[model samples]
Target: MIKKIIFTGGGSSGHVAVNLALIPHLLEQHWSVQYIGSEQGIERKLISGLEDVRYFSISTGKLRRYFDWNNFKDPFKVLKGISQAYRIIRKEKPDIIFSKGGFVSVPVVLAGWLNKVPVIIHESDITPGLANKISSIFATEICTTFPETTQYFRSKHTRYVGAIVRDELKDGEAAKGLTYCGFTRNKPIILIMGGSLGSKKINEMVWMNLEALLVHFQIVHICGKDQVNHSIHMHGYKQFEYINDELADVMAMADMVVSRAGSNSIFEFLTLRKPMLLIPLSKAVSRGDQILNAKSFKAQGFCEFLEEEELESERFVDMILGLYEKRSDYIINMKKMNADHSTSKLIDLIKVYT
Candidate 1:
């Protein structure tokens, strides 16, 4: 019998990224695929371009860390979402469900359990997010990007599968990257990625030190949505709200990267052997997962990290230059690490569970 799979995840691109990487491969193998995401999420926008994968939208609420009046309303929304997901899963009769651990997946995982279908949850951080923590009990298997994460789950079902990077990111050409950016080979390129939504403080720092930074390196800044400053267009600096198709080429030409410490992004940087300076989100705003992710990479000699709280207190430009000087050492450490065939491994696991 042909196998059909239901994929759920996404409040951000990170949650949906693994599903995106896996879906194309499954399609080639003639496995039927479908996605369950929020109606107006970034996932829907990202997945809309793909062919043959049917997309389903369901109600979802943000899993917040702080107080909000919506907190009371969200549970009801989640209950509604569970009903919606249960109905869909019952009708589709998928052999398996893959969740990347977002609020939307909570309902889907619960619904899958109600229908007696196997559900696999992929957690990218060292610690489980709120959504994954809630979904874990119902999950048949849990996949992790960090080996240390398995300690949190006593279940033998939890497997340490390394990071899943998109295949196309590895195919970038430096020449094409330079041509696209109108940059010369005379200087090193630094790519600043603040995440999908962008970082205000990072952008401000970049603008404040633009002249000093340009003296040493060419720069491409993916400054997040509506974060671009069109007023200042210098010879060596390029700023965009976001780049889709050209991101691979940008990665190809980037000698070093200044980015937020999100698991998927860091792993992609590691796979490309790009030296990185990671600035994790602060504990006040998040659950401190990025801080832990950064610490792990620092321990492994993969990158240098600065806490968001230290951005103002530290000599930011000096830190960037220091990282540039020691870039080769970081690359060496990264190269010494074994690379896992994560995408293939996950596919194998899915087949086993199915």
Candidate 2:
């Protein structure tokens, strides 16, 4: 029996949310959980002051494939991070390490491999991130959100367990959540999320078309903490800096969602059976993955892809209005693609490795 577990990964909400999803299961099993992440990452802010979970800091940064001045500094930083992770692993002495694939997970995963601790990586995207790609060589098992991800990894240890979504998202009643988000009974709501830090392009496009959005549907815009300066006086628009623990409700109540094509965010929309309009980050060096994710959803008839460049104010307003007009069709497609209880399947697989 595993008495101690180390959860590593967290630079964005995508990586952090995986750990958050698995926590309840670990707690019920009476496992002591320790989290190792970068001090500079958003994980530090999200997991701060949480009880029962010990948090340790590591010096880490993203490994960009391109030439940058920061690349020169990475080798030393990675060395320091590895040493810090080694010390933490020695002290904590976890039976297994669970990594959710981010820059922070690299040090812990490497250290765990060297120390003979079993490392399991959960890749939450169709295309595995840089850390997961490298860590798969030493990982005992690789858990993926989509089956398509296995082709990217040479490890025969891969298994498709779907995305590990929070229990609240998995089992929570969508209707009640809609009510909590200030929606009236039977009114179709539209949810908007610009990703963890907020997408300036998405935010600007939504802001430009806010007047049109408020006409037919209730809007719950998760404006993200960085971009919450807009006035919230629309007839049916409610804005939040962050949703805290009520994301399930917001998702459940929404008839359709407008969001970025981040894997985690897309999975949430898929699991909730909410039709989506995905605007992937155009500036990313690896831009094709999200576009592919959006394409898959679109091909499956669950969501529509609206490229960032095509998201002019008039175009966005017309597209949303068109979706609202075809609401029933969108709902049917979303329900068809819903895969809600994926976390339990993921935990069951992890138990085998444990």
Candidate 3:
């Protein structure tokens, strides 16, 4: 029988990143890989371009923390999603299902469980996301990025596999990166990443303080798809809608990073030993995962955390400068976090479970 596995994750880049790390390894092992996600989700867009992995989209519904009219309609959509996912799993007969916590993965996990497929779910945040919390019961094993997170679980199935950083990111050329951004090595480059959908507040903060920022650092901003302001033109500032194949080179040229506190993104920064200024999403909007992730990184001396509400142009500019001044100190601490970068351990665990 051919070895086969199904991967499910979506909603945000964090949820989908671990799956991306595993896809190449699975292909190398000669396993047939399939992905299940919502039709319009980020995962479908990111994973569909890969030729080896078969992509399958099903009905999906968002799980909300606040009351919305969609709440009533979403449960029915979830049921429909579960049905569609169940049919796909039954037909594909994947040997295993790997889920990276997201709202879309919940139905997929449940469907895999119903089909008697073994499931493994990886949680990137300090706490389990709402989707992962719901899907945990169906998972045969639960992997976590934060060791502290295992305490909340029953302990038997919990494993600390660390973060999975992509292999392609390790070998970026500074010249290629600089060339791609039309930047020179005369000034230090500061890369700002605001997640998949983009952070409006971060964009505003950067633009508001653009002149101050340009004086000290060359800027390469990943502003999300269609989020760029074509109106702004500056010699030292480069804004891109999004990046894929060129992300490594762009990041390779960066002297420092300013980013959101999504666990996957932060961990990648740590792996690269890049000095980072993190602005986590407010508790009002998210479950405070980013806030806690940022706090942990700060406590470990890996990065500095600035609250979104406290983001003033002057203060934000100061924070970036402060991070730049202490860049070496941050890189030293990040070097000590070197153990988390390896995918071999995660790949081994998946094989044992497979």
Q: What's the lDDT for residue 40 in model 3?
A: 93
Clashing pairs in 1: none
Estimate candidate 2's alpha-carbon lDDT, on a 0 to 1 scale.
0.81
lDDT of each residue in 57-110, candidate 3, tens digit only: 999999987899999999999999999999999999998999997899999999
Point out the higher-scoring one by TM-score: 2 or 3: 3
CA lDDT, candidate 3, residue 224: 85
For candidate 1, the lDDT comes to: 0.92
Off by over 4 Å in 2: 171-187, 283-285, 337-341
Which lDDT value does model 2 have at 345? 74
lDDT of candidate 1 over 1-354, digit per residue (tens): 789999999988889889988998999999999999999888898889888999999999877778999998998989999999999999999999999988999999999999999999999999989999889999999999998899888678999999999998999998889999999999999999898889998999899999999999999999998999989999899999988888899999999999999999999999999999999998988899999999999998999999888896238898899999999999999999887788999999999988
List the lowest-lDDT window of 10 residues for candidate 1.
307-316
CA lDDT, every prediction? 0.92, 0.81, 0.90
Give the TM-score of each candidate. 0.97, 0.92, 0.98
Residues 121-235 of candidate 2 have per-residue lDDT tens digits of 9987788878888889889999888889988888888888777667677566667776677667555788898888877778777777777777677788888876885655766
Candidate 1's TM-score: 0.97
